[model samples]
Target: MNKINELSYNIKIRNTLYFEAAIGLSGNSFLLLFQVFKFIRGQRPRLTDPPIILLALIHLLMLLVMSLVASDIFMPGKRWSDSTCKFVMFLYRFFRSLSLCATSLLSILQAITLSPRNSCLAKFKHKSPYHMLGCLLFLSIFYSSISSPLIKYIAAIPNLTSPGFIYITQSCCLVPISYSVWNTFYTLFTLRDVIFVGLMAISSAYMVTFLYRHKKQSQFLHSTNRSLKSSPEHRATQSILCLMSFFVVMYTLDSVISYLRNPSNDPIFYFIVILVGHSYASVSPFLVLSTEKHVIHILKCYGRTVDI
Candidate 1:
């Protein structure tokens, strides 16, 4: 108890955290609906479609995760009970992992969708949705539940701590587990990142290669004025590229911070980590939605009908 008290430090909750969370939640939730609309109103309705469905699920999970973390920030006080702290930590970790997995899976699916007939990834396109959904379910259950029992954390219990510990009591923290059991949780998370991030990087590069090889042929076959950018597939590929770019940047920054993370480290570092981590979720929908030409078509139709 004394050692735990010595390690705990007071964390100050700032107003910016709440503001970012609120705006992100509102924007993502609304655009998530628009994503669904895009799917439902498509020329061909696909109830079992993996690409559209997985994308929506990713945004939905991102929104839910932002809600959980933000709601905790806005609580009346920094102090939380054992169960509450554990719950917060669990939801945060589990959902964040799922979001990354889904995003990586999305890039792979996009590449497969755009692949040539003979490409290896093309065969898996039809089955990707089921596999992605199943993986999401498995990760959610495994991450959320498995860590609860082994959870080791320190809460700021000012009233219960020794007098010497009274000065710095502020918030609860989910402490790291020992190396003896690291293989079960930490190792899995590391491998997951290595695999998914590698897949996303490789697949994205493959897409670029495919596009480059096809571009000249496409231009020669079509009109000189025909732009590859006019295609829906091209637009989607660009948007997904932007999303992954943002994710990579943030993930890199967060990794650096984690390497430097320590009990005596500045709270601002943690704040920066949280802010950058959520930026992808907050801004990705708008970035992706902007690429959809259907919105423009619908608006033009409405204007013409009104004018008539």
Candidate 2:
């Protein structure tokens, strides 16, 4: 009965991972396609659209690679080649880093968009698409350099697995590094995370303050109107604020779970951390879609097309 229960537990975790992947993939696909369609139709893209598109693409690829990684973890009978393990793990790390970069860019872009003309952020309002993309490209290279060390560490587990090998998946494990090298990489990773997350937090706070001040000024200017609806900028700012908040929450939760599980051998904590780490990517597209009237219109058009 213990064996049977353990088997069932593994199956449940595997199914849940797959389900999350499916939802993430579908939502991101729609988002990507719609954004591309808008660009193709010669519609002037919003400042936030570029980062949103990049983010969706990153999340889509991340989910695809994660699903592949999940198979290696949950399927005990399956094995991956050393080269395959290295390649998949590298892609996952690269895309995960890009996802953070893109999200940070999105939040910053939105904050700039909402900034008043007299504000310091207004200077960035006229930045060309090429400029924004260049920033993303630079950050991508920076993160790729930082994350490249993982390629050297990840390999297929040999038959003579040592206690030093930390399991990343059923077929792949991280070879232990020296204490000095480990601390160096750890510091780099921590610095990268702090910079991006700090940018997100600061941008989020700026948006909140901007919105509140704007609201108060508007109320004072129009004392008779109690039913002043939020403008499009306000709505969009609120949406991105929600997205950033959710991302930070998921990040913190994953970090806590990871720290707690580091000294233990509990598969439950391991699976929970994986789920938590991907939760932002899986759920963010739906959150954005729910806030966009254009996305709603796109869905309605699809419904009409189906009906016809």
Number of the top-ranking candidate, with lDDT as the measure: 2
Expressed as tens digits, the lDDT of each residue in 1-308 for candidate 1 is 86454234322344565567666666667665766675677755322245445555565566566555544443335566766655656666666766776777678777877887787766865563566677656645654455455445434344554532211114444454456665666566566577768988998898888778778777778755246778878777887888788889888887776656555434455557677777776776676667778766876899999999
lDDT, candidates in the order shown? 0.63, 0.85
State in Å the error of residue 213, model 2.
0.4
List TM-scores for all candidates, in order.
0.75, 0.90
Clashes of 1: 0
**Model 1 TM-score, all chains together:** 0.75
Q: Hey, what RMSD does candidate 1 come out at?
A: 6.4
Off by over 4 Å in 2: 1-5, 223-230, 263-265, 297-308
Query: Candidate 2: TM-score?
Result: 0.90
What is the Cα-based lDDT of residue 278 in candidate 1?
Answer: 75
**Each prediction's RMSD to truth:** 6.4, 2.9
